[model samples]
Target: LIYIYDLPADYNARLLQYKHHALACTWRGFDAGNHTYLKDSVYAVETFFHEALAVSSHRTFDPEEADFFFAPTYLTCYMWPVHGWADGPWYHAPIPNPRPMHAANFIDEVGRWVNATMPYWSRRGGRDHIFLWPHDEGACYMPSWIYNNAIFLTHWGRLDADHVSGSGWPPDNYSQPVVYPRFQPLDWRRMYKGHLCYTPGKDALIPAFKASNSYHRSPLVGVPPVKKDVLLYFRGDIGMYREWWYSRGIRQSLYRLAMEDKWREKYN
Candidate 1:
């Protein structure tokens, strides 16, 4: 059974503390519709977990009788107010200036407070504690002291050598069953094979937001099925072809290959 810490009122209060920032102005032309408007992956999961624990039979209020401790705080949601600005399309927009130092500061202060006020944090140096850091930036920005010791639930599970080398995170520090934000369009039939957002074995994809506009339902009136004509379809940008390890070299090559006379005739 999990022993969820009854965090000081202030910790959970931080969500309401930054309510204005969370609902601040977004780019003018951006229209993801009401459904996808404020639906961020980190925020979605954080909310679900909080609600789940609130009603779960497995949760224990007593710290001494618990097997593992849960630290419930919406750290990412708090950071979103400062980092959530957008001037143009998200793909082209630069990230907001001055990375969220508040997140790190919040974690540090919480760690200190917990250590001073409770015996659990110091019992085994937080090895038995769990922290949910779903946002990529939040996971990356966590202070070394807090990140190194606790079990972190994150979405940056693309556990490659580069991530390990850059973050200095021990390979074993993260657990499997990566939790990501809900996908838009709740229906699987509407998703293309190549465009599917998740990795099969490594991820546990959550449900789409109730306000998601990605899902569409056709009228139930009887209608003939439309005939299929096109054999292959591709859309979206080819991305900048650059000489970097993460550049779109493969995409560039595919575009080049598709431009060849024989391939064009075969597909087009």
Candidate 2:
């Protein structure tokens, strides 16, 4: 694995500080109890990959000798404030709108700089270059040109035609899915867009790890499971203000069902 050092000085030097601000802005009054899944997911993969690279004897810094080029871009960390808190309460009156376009622009600038300064990008049209874009919002707003011929690793791997807009960048087999720790069960209706549960060969579905307790055994490990008294249990955000049409429909239906006394009795 070969890592590219193409970002500006500020991004590299103050990375931890930027990440802290981004997380704080994204989750207002965020506490140690309420875990931030997006933040944990990004850092988990980054830490693991870096550790693997460190121990790997095959790793190379030289582009010519490297088998695959890795762009060490903290895209999720940088774009979190823009995507997660732009229209939220954190970015109210007098604050400049955190446009999603800014994320794309940042990526474009990095790509341009890498192409101009490095010879590898042009050598193979970036076919062998790999980029990690864990955040769903960032992945959604990523410019097509950057990942046209490159491999993109992301958490949001829903490859529905509805997601494809003017970007024309539908995440095909090339786009690998890095599955984060899902607290909820898989919803078939929700996974219809990409057939995420069924299509294991198309994209990689990485297993989830406990961020808080890494050394300890998983909750599901080596435990005699309890009886299933309840037929069904569902809990999550419903009818979000800016959610998609299909998502809103599903959430609304679930919310309605949960509210109905008859439905609850039947399930019980």
Candidate 3:
């Protein structure tokens, strides 16, 4: 399951092209350089595969891991070069589409993949770390975000099913409600204008999109890309700003959270 920030008009057709490109590259052999690239590809394939890949089963080797394991990293976006676009530092290809693959369908795919390949995630002592945070604030680590939103929740719940029975592992299928929040018409248009940096001129946009988290300390901070831009403001940079400006309520909550020292690891 792939989590996308934006869906273009021709998203389905474009994805088929990406799949074709990826498949063609499969025959290329891996090299020493690929290993170096993998180290920065965010965990060199999920850590769960450390054991699975070591066993050398031809069929079950997990191509997803292998593709990620040897995928290249560039200071610039290198994901869909054939599409004639360069994102910031992150690299991700669009999933082949039946178009608009909803969250429910994606979650089911995640459950099947995890259960079939890493069933051990549900057994013994390897529970807590079964999931990896996929969003990495847009960089070589960006997969951390996509992976988290796409597969982590499903896998984590599946792994912890014994403790949190029916804790929403495979999301309710057949009942996906289109619940994307309605954006103000003007606001939505601005978002589609492509990647822009966090600066005072765009300060008004902050309050409109701000989300609070212990991971953030400053009231105003730069957030990563939710969509791709043909041109990037910063070379390989995803700059987000946290604002203590208008949302005094959120700021106050953060202050109390800070006073209690509830999120030291994240803030520090």
Best model number under lDDT: 1
Off by over 4 Å in 1: 21-42, 82-97, 158-268
Candidate 3 structure, TM-score to reference: 0.22
Q: Specify the poorest-scoring 10-residue window by lDDT in model 1.
A: 187-196
Q: Per-residue lDDT tens digits of candidate 1, residues 118-228? A: 899889888787777665323444555666667666654443322321222222122211212342223221111122122234234343222233223313344455455
Task: Provide TM-scores for the models.
Answer: 0.51, 0.54, 0.22
Better of 1 and 3 by lDDT: 1
Best by TM-score: 2
Cα deviation of 54, candidate 2, in Å:
4.6
Looking at model 3, report the run of 10 residues with the lowest lDDT sum. 202-211
lDDT of each: 0.49, 0.47, 0.25
For residues 217-255, could you state the per-residue lDDT of candidate 3 as single tens digits? 442476553443332111111212333322324445555
Ranking by lDDT: 1, 2, 3
Candidate 1 structure, TM-score to reference? 0.51
| Overall local distance difference test of candidate 3 | 0.25
The Cα error of candidate 3 at residue 68, in Å, is: 20
